[model samples]
Target: MAGSGDAAKEYIAGSAAGVAQVVVGHPFDTVKVKLQAHNTKAHRKLYKNASHCTSRILVEEGIRGLYKGASSSFVGIALESSLFFGTYAHAKQLLQGKYEDGKPQLQVIIPSAACSGALISCILTPTELIKCRMQVQGKDAMHATWYSSPLDCAVKTLQSEGVRGIFRGGLATLFREAIGNAFFFCSYEYSRYWMHSYTDSPRFAGNSNLILAKDVGIGIISGGISGMAFWTTTLPLDVAKTIIQTDPSPLSSRNPLRVLSMVYRRAGLAGCYAGLGPTLARAFPANAAAIVAWEYSAKVLGIRGS
Candidate 1:
């Protein structure tokens, strides 16, 4: 069993990473969600592209519009990341049992990451549902009553659709997280190793020093690349998830695969990856910050064993 102390440290580190991720990425995320949800209708198309969408938000809603659903995101990511990193640490420890060596093989890392992702989905689904709803709504006066706040969104959702409604796209979230995280951790680990090897630096894995520029750079590159890897592979599912969560029609299918099929029929493959541009843009910096924060916080807490 992993020590409670170690688990607590992992949670703290992950929380730091989560905060960093959201602060850096939420604006991009808002744009991505909006693009994914609104671009489906040809007759009612909102924005032509990412830049246009961004400019409109800035002009109409200002910088604050870029972070429209940030409150739910902050809370969701913090809690989900804490549970994910903490769980992954313990799961990897158990899987690696007595190894006490360099990086564990992909076999160990994959299952550990998958398990952590699956568990965190329970927490992630509801919060993401709220965030997506808030993000998809425009700043128009007609939409003012949609959700006054995250709490109000939750209350209204509960009143209208009940508990199951809060977790509308949970199945897609499950597959996305479980599969995406396996890729995420694997890519991160390998990228970190490659960076360490290429630079001939020992600090990439673990460092006793309080701070090092090289180490932070390595973390940024590795985390950013890994994030891109995660989204590139799972974006279709994400598109499905967004549609499922935001569609106002009571008759819209809640099934992710079905949603994807529906989108495929309407707009073909490109439609399924509606928000690819902004997602990739957000993934790099957001995940870079997350890894840098996670590593530094872990070192400070004395929990990074490498």
Candidate 2:
């Protein structure tokens, strides 16, 4: 009974932390995506660096520009992370309770996170679509005069492509979130453990580190490495997803390799990674801070996220 209760608490706490992540880091996410996927031509080669990109966006679009699609992103992150971490926390509890031969198995970890991520994909797709359209609104508005606002985009999608249009890039989004988040949390947990064990830092995984002058540096390093890995793995899919979301048409092919070949032919290798640098820079800090905040929040709520 105690164990089950612990699990339930953890699940609830995870959702709380997820909410924390979105509130703190979403604007950076907005700028990152817009700089990459905006359908603009004047700012085609917009920011020469991550800082430049953000500054340019603010200068051109104002503070609200920095927060474009914020509400949608908030909704998407809140829903997705709630489902994601809630399921993941509960699944971990269930797996721990069901131990193989009375011992927890390490192999099931990946599967648990995978299942959590898949469910989150469904919850996230529509709102994320709204967020995407809003973020990319400023990208050379000439070619993307299709929708007046995020709502219009949603309406147009429903009108033209039906349910699938609203979720035009859902499959890729699913793969991105499921695989990306599975690895994200999994990597985060493992890295935190190794850091706690190896480093001499006080407060290896939380904002509480400020109190300890911490050396839990591994979390940052591990997060960066993992972020890079996850992004690289799904980058091709991301490219495809972006194309489907932003381009005038849905991708006819699902094969990752074929999409790459086509993208290369049409947009070139540079196009494949059109907005990669900002993405990584943005992703690394946003994700790392999110993970740290999430894990710490769970602990504060008396739930063991790991």
Candidate 3:
């Protein structure tokens, strides 16, 4: 009964934190997606850089443009975060049971996070496909008619391409989520563990009672590092995923690796990281706030991190 109650609390906390993360992060994400999907070789490039994209979005579409696909992102993130944190908690518990001291090492935590990430990727692919399609619209007349909103995008995709339409970038998403999250969770847990050791704080010494301020601070640091690690490790896959998801033509979206190869051939290595600036800019603060929000909310709900 107690374990079930704690799990419920953790789920709620994760959902709230996910909403908070999307609110803080979506604008930057919009810019990043646009830039990643932009065709630089065009006679008139849509955006020269991250700042240019931001300014153009402001001038052309107003503030609302910055949050074009926020509704979809909100829903997607809320579901993803709830599943991720809840799964991680349960996986940690299972690992603890396996260990003699009832405290799993980083090896256990890493695989747990990886598996959770893979599971979440199943849902995330379609969610992001809809969101990215909506976001790329409104940038120009060519794309403006592509989608009226996230819902319209999803509906159109269903009608045009069937159920498989929504999962355009599932392979890339799976790879990115699984591999990237492995690094992200490992970095976060290792950083927190190091902080506990370095500070020698009793609160961080055990899993039961962590100091709120210290934990939040460490979460911020860990989140930033993890964000960088994720992006660095999976930027190419992410770029491919974005391109595949945002492509308007049904036939063009068939092979992510083919698209990636074309991108590499056309633009070289740099092409694989088109929107890196905006992505990195968004990753740190956004993830920091998200991790802090998740940890803080969990604490408020009487769910301690193991």
Query: Which pairs clash in model 1?
Result: none
Ranking by lDDT: 1, 3, 2
lDDT, candidate 3, equals: 0.82
lDDT of 1 at 205: 45
Q: What does candidate 1's lDDT look like per residue over 1-306, in tens digits?
A: 657887899999999999999999999999999889888754456889999999988998999889988999899999999999889888888988756667648878999999999999999999999999988877663332479889999999898889989999999999999999999999998889877767764454455452377778889999999999999999999999999988876577988998999888887888899999999999999999999999989988987733
Top lDDT hit? 1
| Model 3: per-residue Cα lDDT over 1-306, one tens digit each | 238889898788888778877988899999988888885333445677899999989999999999988999899999999998888778877776666553237768888888889999998999999888877876464552467778888898899889988898999999899899888888887887787667655555555444656777788898888888888888889889998887777777556678778888877777878888888888888888888888888877877753
Give candidate 1 regions above 4 Å deviation. 42-44, 98-101, 141-145, 201-211
- For each predicted model, how many residue pairs clash, with residues at least 3 apart or on different chains? 0, 2, 0
When sorted by TM-score, best at the front, the candidate numbers are 1, 3, 2
Clashing pairs in 2: 40-139, 40-140
Which residue ranges in model 3 land beyond 4 Å of their true spot? 40-44, 100-104, 201-211
lDDT of 2: 0.65
Candidate 1 Cα RMSD (Å): 2.5
Model-by-model lDDT, in order? 0.89, 0.65, 0.82
Q: On a 0 to 100 scale, what is the lDDT of residue 280 in model 1?
A: 100
Judged by whole-model lDDT over C-alpha atoms, candidate 1 comes out at 0.89
Which candidate has the top score in TM-score?
Answer: 1
